[model samples]
Target: MPQGPLFLARAVYRRRRLRDAARLLPVFGLLLLLLPAFGEQSGNLAHTAIYLFAVWALLILAACLLAPALSRSEAEGDPETDQGPQDMGDS
Candidate 1:
């Protein structure tokens, strides 16, 4: 009984991820920022969040600029579908 619901939950989450990766980026970023700021003084987690947002922003911008080339290469070879670690970048 527990295994069945767990599998269903995982599958549902995976489906949502595939539908909207952008929606998740900010959420994970926020969790990364908020979760660690619980104890102590000064919030190092905020700084970490800023760094993450910066990296994510840069990657999205770069990906947009190279969309044509990326799509072409993907259509041609479908890297992740057929290749190794390099293909992880493909949409």
Candidate 2:
């Protein structure tokens, strides 16, 4: 019963915060795609496209920067059950 790297990855991804963040990524991408539609309403297609592209790029960069911090915080908050000080002399 040996688990592979994929199993380990899935386990880490199951963390609540990480899972929520993963779910939000697709929704964010969808919003980015839909942004052009809203810009069209403003009657300045080119400007709107440029603005949305910049916004989309910035958001992706932010997400990449924040993802590692999120994982580190989650790891820190979860206590390791296998390693801890044990009481002695009271068997």
Candidate 3:
């Protein structure tokens, strides 16, 4: 029997996943921010502030870690490109 089709190379696969995560980061952050609203309304301003700060810090760290890999992938000339309109009237 023939083997299954080959999977994507590890680097490409990892970069694609990273791109996905980068795209989803904002939505993830929003959900995390909303998490406290779903919990008990303890009315403790300090604890809520701490949670918000922690979430903000985590999002920043995640972006920092992902930025390098994402930039490297772009520098490598990823196959997907935005093919804009070909006709621009002025030179």
Instruction: Pick the TM-score winner.
Output: 3
Candidate 3, backbone clash total: 0
Best of the two (1, 3) by TM-score = 3
Ranking by lDDT: 3, 2, 1
Q: What is the TM-score of each candidate against the true structure?
A: 0.30, 0.47, 0.75
lDDT of 3 by residue, 1-91 (tens): 4454388667767778988999999999999999999988876889999999999999999999999989998888544343556455755
Preferred candidate (lDDT higher): 1 or 3 = 3
Candidate rank order under TM-score: 3, 2, 1
Q: What C-alpha lDDT values do all the predictions have?
A: 0.55, 0.67, 0.85
lDDT assessment of candidate 1: 0.55
Candidate 1 C-alpha lDDT tens digits along 3-44: 333344543454444435555656765665565456465758
lDDT winner between 2 and 3, please give it: 3
Clashes of each: 0, 0, 0
C-alpha lDDT (0 to 100) for residue 75 of candidate 3: 85
**What is the C-alpha lDDT profile of model 2 across 1-91, one tens digit per residue?**
4343544443444555575776687688778777777654757767876877887887788689668867776676533333578566666
Q: Residue 1's C-alpha lDDT in candidate 3?
A: 43
Lowest lDDT 10-residue stretch of candidate 3: 78-87
Clash-forming residue pairs, model 1? none
